[model samples]
Target chain A: MTSQLEALRRELDRINEEILKWLNRRAEVVQEIGRLKLKQGINRFDPVREREMLDHLVRINTGPFDDQTIRALFKQIFAASLKLQQKQHEDALLV
Target chain B: MTSQLEALRRELDRINEEILKWLNRRAEVVQEIGRLKLKQGINRFDPVREREMLDHLVRINTGPFDDQTIRALFKQIFAASLKLQQKQHEDALLV
Candidate 1:
């Protein structure tokens, strides 16, 4: 039982590390998207695009998490991504 | 230029899908952790453990997103995971 618990803990740690890597990868891609949007004179916050992404996740989620939970988590991600872009733009303006 | 934009969009989509998968995998592992905790009569929320995880990410992060942004994103993920565990426990109680 202790070994089972230890194995699960290790799995959790492994999954956590993978999630962190993917999240950082996603952030970098979002940064590229932000740069393109800026160059095109488009705003970073696109409600339509955000909605579509959320809908796609909802459709694909086969979960230990329900759709509401999935939506909420991704919304947090989207919010942070927008903040990152906005912060970058603000810094650029000051430069 | 249009092709470049399309390629970036495709990359974003692929990365989003990967992040979603890892996030869900993280959720499942968290669920298992919650189960074991319950079996051991332990609580789900462990601030020290969470802090350790965050510190690990911070130490390793090579970021397009800053540490603050990374922390905020992971905090949201952690919050949602806890909510999932609590909801599941509540549902079990009601059943």
Candidate 2:
């Protein structure tokens, strides 16, 4: 059981690194979008797009997780990306 | 520019799926850990361990995101996993 636990923890550590990599990748895309939107004078927040993304995720979800929990987690991720983009935008303006 | 935006959005979609997979993987590990802790009469929360994880992440973090933001993101991930484990524990109790 201890060995099993150790293996699981090792897997968790690997997953954490994968998550960090994906998050940074996502952030890079989000920042690019932010820049494009600014250039086009488009709105920063798009509720319709966000909703569509969530709905797509729900349709694709084959869970050990329910749809609601999936939505919640994705929303948190979305919010983080949004926050990162916003911060970048602010910094750009300040410069 | 529009093509670039579309490409970026596609990349974001791919990253989103990767994040979902990792999050689920992390959740499974957390659940197993929760079970082990319960069986061993160990405490559910471990502040020192959590701090060590965060500190390790900080030491390894590479740019575009500061230590604070990385810590915030990891903490959010940790909280979600904890909530998942608690719910599983509750359900196990009811059974």
Candidate 3:
């Protein structure tokens, strides 16, 4: 029983590690997009694109997490990513 | 110009999909752990374990995300997963 918990925890930890790496990768891509947008004088936050992405993710979701939960979690990540972009843009302006 | 944005958006979309899948996989593991806890009559939330996980994630993080942001995002995921577990446990009792 204890060993079962150990094994499950290990798997959970592994999954969390993968997620951390992927989230960082996603942030890197967002950073690149932000740089491009700044160069083009385009706004960084694209609500239409975000809505479409969320919709697609919700549609494809098969879960122990319901669609709403999936939407909420991803939305937090998206919001954070946007914040990071805005901070970068601000820092660039100050330079 | 447009092509570059398009390419970046595609990569972002792909990474989002991957993250979505990984989140679900993580949820599945959480469910297993939940079941084990339920069987053992143990409390569902483990603050010490959670603290450990977050600390390890923070230490390993190399990011466009600051450690606080990493903690916040994972905490949200962890909270949601705990809710999922509780809901399952309640449903089990109803059966």
Evaluate every candidate with DockQ and list the scores.
0.72, 0.57, 0.92
Task: Pull out the clashing pairs in model 3.
Answer: none
Q: Which stretches of candidate 2 lie over 4 Å from their true place?
A: none
- The TM-score measured for candidate 3 stands at 0.97
lDDT of 2 by residue, A11-57 (tens): 78778878777777787789889999888887888888889888988
lDDT string for model 3 (B1-95, tens) is 59999999999999999999999999999999999999999998899999999999999999989999999999999999999999999999999
Best by TM-score: 3
- Report every candidate's CA lDDT: 0.81, 0.81, 0.94
Top candidate (lDDT): 3
* Candidates 2 and 3, the one with greater DockQ: 3
- Highest DockQ scorer: 3
In terms of TM-score, which candidate is stronger, 1 or 3?
3
Candidate 3 residue lDDT tens string, A1-95: 49999999999999999999999999999999999999999977889999999999999999989999999999999999999999999999999
- Candidate 1 lDDT over residue span A10-56, tens digit each: 88778777877877787777888877877888766879978998999
lDDT of 2 by residue, B1-95 (tens): 48877887788777778887777778888988999888887778878878877887778777456678778888888887888888888888899
Candidate 3 ranges with C-alpha deviation above 4 Å: none
RMSD in angstroms, candidate 3? 1.0
Ordered list by TM-score, greatest first: 3, 1, 2
